[model samples]
Target: MSNLNSLQYFIPELFLIVAILVIIVVDLFLKKNKKIVSAYLAALTLVVTIFLAYQQYGYSPALLFKGMIVLDSFAIFFKIITALSTLIVIFISLPSFRTKAEYYVLLLIVTLGMFLMVEVNNLLMIIISMEMVGLISYVLVGFNKHDLKSSEASLKFMLYGATSTAVMAFGFSYIYGISGHLNLDVIQQSLIINQPQALPLFVAFMMVLAGLGYKIAMVPFHFWVPDVYEGAPTPITAFLSVGPKAAGLALLIRFLITLVAHPSAGNAANFIQNVSIHAPLLLAALAVATMTLGNLSALMQKNIKRMLGYSAIAHVGYMLMALVVFNNQGIIAVMFYIVVYLFMNFGAFCVVESLTDKLGSEKISAYTGLGYRAPFTAIAMAIFMFSLTGLPPFAGFIGKLYLFAAVINQSWYILALIGLLNSVISLYYYATVVKVMFLNRQENAPPLRVALYNKLLIGALLIPTLVLGLYWSPVINFTSRSIGFLFGK
Candidate 1:
């Protein structure tokens, strides 16, 4: 599809752009609760955008913007992920950021960036979309200028993002030079037919991986994650944890599927140009390192936010484990994992965000005796903890089951074993939160009261976290259909 034809499929993104401009103008005139009004408008904008994105789901996948992007069920699936994550984050944000209308506006821009992140089909679009998201994220991380950590985090995040962008662009330049094209499919065909030399292609692949890997918190590229998560406002941390990360993964999967790997028979994937690249084996190692490091580091953290920060990395490792297979099984497992992760992670963060205001601390100790002091929140946190830990009867368990199943089915027993041990190790820290909440006694403690709206928010995220655990066939089926089109091509 050309630019003009792309507009019909591009309504959601365009609407988001128009909404950002309109809300900024609206914020100027409001005297009271400007942020509140802007937040509601932002919420409305996301709701409408989600509906528009859903409308795109039934259409056949088409290359849009003259082959710069593709409109497909795969992209639409991730669009929903980004939008739902953003929509909920807006509600979670309103409580703390009611004074800054611009805060909401910045969030809307990040949402726009995430939207572009999943739809990219050209190598140039990859850099452009990532830079757009990265720049705004740097600003969002430091939105609280009063806090020194926030400022420091913003600086580190910007530096890291800039370095990764340059490396990615450098790698992409090699690719474009060799292929003489910018569109991913065309570049892929060039690679297949011309068979570029091994050394340059290897360097380019790793460089590009480093860039995309940074977004998903892949190890060696993940140094910025903990600091950024801890320093950013809780709501922004929640958004960073899921929204942009999903976009990164979706983009990565598409990049690899389109450029690096090709269909091998009915259900296998392999390097398009060379078998010795061992991409799957390399990713498997990263997955192990990521999960082990994340779980071990999280065990040492006292701050709840920081703990969840490491936990997010571990979850990324789990998703990467599935990516090792790089087939329909792998894609299905990864997609389903992303969906469950969104709910469980948001619910956990929602509890932290709701409680940190009253407790004055995000430490695990702060939650001691919370089982009695704030039973609702404590119980909710415990459920999220169990889900995050991948316990049975929880969505996280189902997510992990699919992940491990995919690897085991491929006879990667050793990788699956390491993943299992990591899951067991994670139970300790996650259960630590549960233990502190239910068992530790706090004498003369006051009863905690969470705001009605925040409670509503928790419930909104909670239902899916629980429902998906016991009954998730519909979700799996949906993921299968979404990937069917992409893999079919």
Candidate 2:
């Protein structure tokens, strides 16, 4: 399709661009006291964007912008995910950030960047979209300008992010030199026809993985996660835990799909055997390291946000296991788990935000006697905690069940076993918070009060987390259909 013709399929992104500019101009006229209007405008834009994206469901997959971007079930699915995550973050952030127009503007821009990240097909687009997200993220991490930790976190995040981007760019240069192509599909065909040296190809691919892995908070590249999570505003931390991570995973899946032989091809094993590089085994090793490090480190955290940061890393490890399978079923499982993970992880962070607002602390000890003071909030938090631990009758359990089943079906028993053990190890830390809230007591503890808005939000998140555990067939079917990209549908 011509670039002009592609505009029709690109309405959602165009709308976001316009919305971002409108928000910036609108914020300039509003006084400090009226900054909430900017937030409301941002939220409305996201709602409209979500509606536009949802309308794209079931549409045939097609290349857009002269094949630089893709419009398909997969891109549409992730666009909705990013939009909904932004909307929820806005709502939860309202009470805390009453008059920060710039903060809201940066958030909208980041959301726009994420929309592009998932749809990218060209290597140049990938670098542009990722840098857009990364630059905005650095400012957001240091939004609390006067706080030392926020500044430090931003510095750490910027250094790590910059180094990784440079490494990825260098890798891209080598690929272009070898194949003379920037589009991923074109690169794949060139590599196949030219049959480049195994050593250079392996090194280039690993360097590219470093950049993608850093975005998703995968291990060794995850040094910035804990401090950044603990220092950034709580709502931003919640958004980071799910939104960009999901976008990065989508990009990874698309990139890997282009390079590897399709799982259905009979020569899949032969390709791996003849090639000197072993992509699956390498990913499997990273999965094990990420899981082991995240879980073991989480065990020693005192701050709840820092602990959840580690937990998020561990969850990425689980999702990586699905990618290692490299099949249609594996892709479906990853999507399903991401859906389940969005609610439970965000719900947990909401509780943390609310508690921090009320008690002025993120330490675990702040939760002592919470059950006696605020029974409803305590119960809801208990459910979130248990669900996160992947116990039965919760959404997280079903998510993990599908992940393990996918790996086991592919005869990856060792990876599955390690994942199961990690789940067990995670229980200790999750239960520690639960125990402090309900089982531990203080003599003179005052009764805690939860605002009506927070209670309603918590309840809203809780229902889905519980219901999906019982009847998830609809979501599973949706995910299965969404994997059409694997089959070239």
Candidate 3:
């Protein structure tokens, strides 16, 4: 399609860019104490973006902007998820942090970048979008300028992020040199026709994976997660855990689909043989290492944010397991897990944010006697913890079931076994938090009360976590439809 014709399909992103500029101007005119107005405005922008993105659903996939971006069910679905996650982060920020217009503006920009990250069909667009998200994230991580740990975390994140970007760029240069093409579809066709040397292809891809891994906090690239999560403002940490991670997964899936044999080719047995490199085995190894390291490390953390940070990495491993199959079922499982994860993970962080506000500490010890001190809050937290652990009758359990079923159906027994064991290991730590809250109550602890707004928000997140457990057909059907891409039926 011509650039002018593409403008119709690009309406949502165009609206977002205008919204962000308007937010910056509005913030400039507001007094420092009145910055809360900007927060409300940001939330309203995201709500409108969500509706606009939803309207694009069910349209046949089409490439826009001279094939730099693709508008499809996959991209639209992730756009809605990213916008919703940011909207929730705004509410999560409202209760605790001093309202700052700049923070919300940065968040809006980050959301815009994520929308591009999932839709990019060219290498140039991919690097531009990833860096956009990365640069904005550095500012958000260190937004708490008064805290030394926050500053330190920002420095570490910046250093690592820069190194990974350089490595990925180097890899992309190699790909372009060999294929003589910048578009992913062209690159895939070139690689298949030329059949490049396996060693160089493997190394180049691995380098590119480094950058994607850093975004998702995959192990070996995960050194920055704990400190950053513990130091950043709680709401930003929550946003980092879910929003960008989902975007990274979307990018990974799209990249992999380009290289592997198409599902419609009717040669499932030779899927890996068709690819130039051993992507399946390499990804499986990363999945195992990521989950094991995250679970083992989380067992010893004292801070709630740090523990959850590691837990986030482990969940990435679970999602990666779905990718091992490289089929429609695996993609559907991934989409379903991401939707369920957004609610349960964000709900857990909200509880932690509320407790931190009340007690001025994020230490696990602060949770002592929470069962009696804050019964409603404690019960809601228990549900979140259980769901995250993938226990029965929770949305997370259903998510895991689909993922493991996808893996096992393809005869990846060892990968499935490792994932199962990791789930059991996760239970011990999750249950420990529950036990501390309910079983080891401190004597003479005073009763605590959560704010009405917080209680309602917690209830809002909790109901989905429980309701999806019992009846999840709506989400399952939505995700199953949303996995369609421009190149697939």
Candidate 4:
């Protein structure tokens, strides 16, 4: 009977699957005008999933399938974020995909993949979930059918994603062979027993990191980011930039804290000693490279979406600093940063979506005189850009502050310094977008009629950016508590 309770733990995911099936049935039966029903069904499913996650909050861990799936605050938090982000994506996509039915279906599948990515404990499950999401995203990116650029982008994304997945699978197979267990906890326990194998273990770990890094678009593995971003639909680009990115980060936390840690007592002793000597140095390099590469490339971008693409890579560098700390505070800081990033980023993408639909303009220069022509969008966008730049009195600044503090607390002063310097460099390009909107002058720009849905969505998110600027304590506390549940350390 207690085992049955474990099934209840997956209520949110079960709800999502049922929602997907219902939407598919409705799509089959509904004709013409009835097609919009799928969007509503998608939205309803997301809302219900969020509600289910909320209900599960503050509960003790509920383990399922001999502990392959654990229902805890950490999973619940990511689940909620994924669901909310998907809901908003659907809303934004409705106008973006007026004629495409497959777009909504693909989105549903991606959401399923993301939900599983955050909750699963087995490495194979993680890879499978990632492939599911990656496949759907590739299709969505090229769904325009007539656009050759879109097709090219989809092909690149698929090839890159497939190669990365294969690399990760090889790494997982090594871990399973070494430890004789697929569960993360079992692997962690095995590492504790065999400390001498650190060299081989680290190699496998790096390979796995390589694959996950590609998903997050970290430096070196980030080659495919800008092209894919530029070629995809504006709304789909926004979704990719936010949804999968966050899910990937979430899984990184789980992997780093659970699977990477040594499990046996004597092995753990040797492992801990070596990690302090080598891990920080390795992460520091990643920090410098990712941020420098992303910022330098973003400076040359003509398309606003592609620029944001490079910017997202740089942003990952900032978040990566927290992970380098590898402690409770670092995890909390990263969680908080991701939460803030979702708002600031999705909000920025919303502005791009609004402008693209309104003016049919995507070039950076197209934003000139928008401050006067579309005051609300311009102001909202300016706020998002400033937030992205880590400026004062914005959520981005607070997120960065906490992340830096986490690094400093761990005595990784060098990484904290590099992260701060990157923020300074990032501000230059992020500010350029603001300058294009308000500082650059143009005459007789046409008026843009902002859709009510877009307005409501942007307006809803702007409050958090402003509020977090002044009162970030609650968010920090919630994130810290959630991280505690995640690591139990």
Candidate 5:
């Protein structure tokens, strides 16, 4: 689509851009409750943006802005995901970041970056959007300038982000040198027609994967995750855990199917036929290592946020299992799992943030006798823990079931078994959190008071986590539909 035609379909982003500016202007004048008012405005904007995104779902998919981006269901789906996640992040920020208007401003800016992250269709947009998100994230991570850990995490995050993106851009140069194009579709055609040699193309592909993997916190590229999660403000840590990670996965899936893999007849499957890389063999290795290392490391973490950070890495590995097959079913599994994970992971973090606000601690020991002190929140935390462990009658179990089934459908039975065993290993650490909360006794501990929104927010996240487990067909069908345009069906 041309620039003029693209604008109509891009209303959600336009509204967001306008709203961000308005909020900044609004913040400048207010002396009282400035951050609260700005956050409320940001949340309102996201609600409207989510509505605008839904409207685009009915629009026919198009290459917007002269192929710079694609307006499609897949992109729309992620737009809503990132926006909605950030909305929750805004509310959560009221506790730790409500005093500073810059926190809300930076958040809105990073949300814009994430919006562009999913819709990118050109190789250059990848670098542009990613750096936009990365730079803002560094600022947000270090927002608590007084905290040494926060400052340290920000520096490490910046270094890792810069290195991966530079390597990935270098890889993109090699790709353009070979394919002579920057647009994903054009690059795909060029590579298919020219049939580049195996070795160089494979190396270039891995470099790009390293960049995407780092964003999603895939192992080896995941060195920054634990520290970043622990040191950043709880709200920002929660945002980091979900928002950018989902965008990275969106880009990864689109990049793989469009540039490396070919959509099979009738858009029924995706396979790396044109590209010479052994994606399945390599992805399987990463998945195994990511999960094993995450689960093992998580078992030793004393801080709740750091444990969830490693746990986030483990969940990424689980999602990667579906991609080892790289079929339409696998795609649906990944998309569904990401949604399931958003609620479970955020709920766990929410519980931690809420309690930490009152207790001024993030350690597991602080949660002793939580069941007696804060029964409702403790129970909610237990549900999140159980769901995270992929237990029965929760969204996480259903999500994992779909992923395992997808891998099995391709006859990758051994890989599926390994994933199941890893799930068992994860159970120990997740259950340990529950055990500490309810089983360990702490006499005369003070009663913990949770704010009204925190209580309501946990219920909001909890409902979907449990209901989706019982009635997940709607979401399954929705995810199946969302990828239609990705494969041009």
Candidate 6:
């Protein structure tokens, strides 16, 4: 009965579950008319869930379900981001995926899973939620089954996801066997006590990190990204890049701050600290490699989507550089970067979706002479590309500034310099898309028409890119407070 009483603490998740069931039931009855119902329900559910999350803002943390989950500021922050990002993705998808209603259902489940990913305190719950999210994404990636590209994307994503899951499970088994604890906090405690036996522990943790790195598409584990992104539908690609990436980062954050950074472990603690310092080096190397590789690969791509796919990988490297810092500033910078990334990446995809739907082409040359045909969209794409390349007067520039600043503050000067250089290298490819849009001349390019709903969505995203770029203080402050609140500071 006492454990049951703890239900009060799980209102956000409860609301989400109830909403999912309601949406599912509604879909069962509505048949072809189901998407409208599902969309509204999903959006309303997320809004209510966000409200519930806000209600828990000042509440003390409480463990529930036999200590498998805990509500804290960190979880709440990610929950809110998950909910909001889902809402945005649903809107973004509406114009592109109206023919496929299943996206609504899959997206809701994925969002719920991501929310759970943040709240779980135990490895079992984390694995369950992580897999739940991954499965939904696999479906979403290939939702347009008629498209051979979509099918290929789905297959590649599923194969990679399965392998990563198996690796993670294997690593978890080692962690449990070695530490004799399933709860992350308890496992951290055990690792500290067994610090003298560090080799086995480091190996165990690295395996787990390797699995997570795959999810985030970090170096050595990022090979599948561009193929999957290019092959997936535009809206689904947007969700894949932003939603899962953010969830992966949230899980990574939970693991690092709670599990690996515990102070009681002598050698293990030192190992983590060394990681904090050397992480920049590893990420710096990865950053240089990823950005150069991604850009160089993107340079040869004719498909616009594939170009963005490689660009996303390079962006991952940048985000990882911030992660390499592993401090509060770095964490806040990461969260901030995600917000900007969502707008910039989604905006770019919106343009892609709009253009493809209208022009029936995804080729880079298809954008030739498009500036005169679709002035608003071309201009928007230019802005997004500029932002993506970290140019001034855009949020991407600010995001990169803060990220580099955080890295340098940690005394990772070379990492900072490498990041700066990568940004410059990235500019060329990103500019190539812009050049085609504005400078290239071609024959027989038709006029582009955008839906009213899409125009509104694009305009809505544009406001944030401009606002956050010039006035980032509020976001930085909120994110900093959110980070401090995570560890109960």
Model 2: C-alpha RMSD to truth?
1.6
In candidate 4, stretches whose alpha carbon ends up further than 4 angstroms from where it belongs are 1-5, 262-271, 274-277
- Report each candidate's C-alpha RMSD, comma-separated, in the order given: 1.3, 1.6, 1.4, 2.5, 1.5, 2.7
Q: Over 4 Å off in model 3, which ranges?
A: 263-268, 272-275
Q: What C-alpha root-mean-square deviation, in Å, does candidate 1 show against the real structure?
A: 1.3
Candidate number of the best lDDT = 1
Question: How much lDDT does each candidate structure score?
Answer: 0.89, 0.88, 0.88, 0.81, 0.88, 0.78
In candidate 1, position 454 carries an lDDT of 89
Model 1, residue 12: what's the lDDT? 93
lDDT of 3 at 246: 93
Candidate 3 structure, TM-score to reference: 0.97
Flag the better candidate by lDDT, 3 or 4.
Answer: 3
With a 3 Å backbone cut-off (N, CA, C), the pairs that clash in candidate 5 are none
Question: 1-489 in candidate 3: lDDT tens per residue?
Answer: 779999999888899999999989988888878889999999999999999999999999888978888888989999999999999999988876546888888999999999999998899899999999999999999999999999999999999999999998988887887788888877877866777777677777888899899999998899999999999988999999999999999998887766555535322354546346767787889999999999999999999999999999999999888888777788889889998899999999999988897877899888988999999999999999999999979999999999999999989999999999999999998898899899988899888878988888889999999988899999999987887563366
Winner on lDDT (3 vs 6): 3
lDDT tens digits, residues 1-489, model 6? 146877888888788888888878777777674457667777788788889898887666667777788777767878888788888888877765554555687788898899888778798887899899988888888888898988998999999988988888887887788778888777766756664255555666667777787888777778888889888878878877888788888888777655456432222223354222233354557666766677677777888888888888788888878877676777888899988998999899888887786777888887887788888888988999999999989999999988998888878787778788878888888888889888986677667777878788888988898888999998887688776545446
TM-scores of the candidates in the order shown: 0.98, 0.97, 0.97, 0.95, 0.97, 0.93
Candidate 5 — which residues are off by over 4 angstroms?
A: 265-274
Q: How would you encode candidate 4's per-residue C-alpha lDDT over 1-489 as one tens digit per residue? A: 155667777787788788777778778888767687778777787888899888988888766767777677888788878877888888878876654555777787898899888887888789889999998999998998799989999999999999999999998888887788888877766765665366666777888889999999998899999999989887788888888988999898778765544322121122355332355566668877998899889988888999999999999988887877676777778889888888898899988887785667789888888888878988999999999989989999999988899889768887788788888888888888889888997876667778888888888878888888889898888776675555453
RMSD to native, candidate 6 = 2.7
Residue-wise C-alpha lDDT for candidate 5, range 242-325, written one tens digit per residue: 999999999998788765676442322345465677778888899888888898899999999999999999999998988888
Question: Of 2 and 4, which scores higher on lDDT?
Answer: 2
CA deviation > 4 Å runs, candidate 1:
263-269, 273-276
> Clashes in model 3: which pairs?
none
- Which runs of model 6 end up more than 4 angstroms from their true locations? 31-35, 263-288, 443-446, 485-488
The positional error of residue 319 in candidate 2, measured at the CA in angstroms, is: 0.5
Q: Between 3 and 5, whose lDDT is larger? A: 3
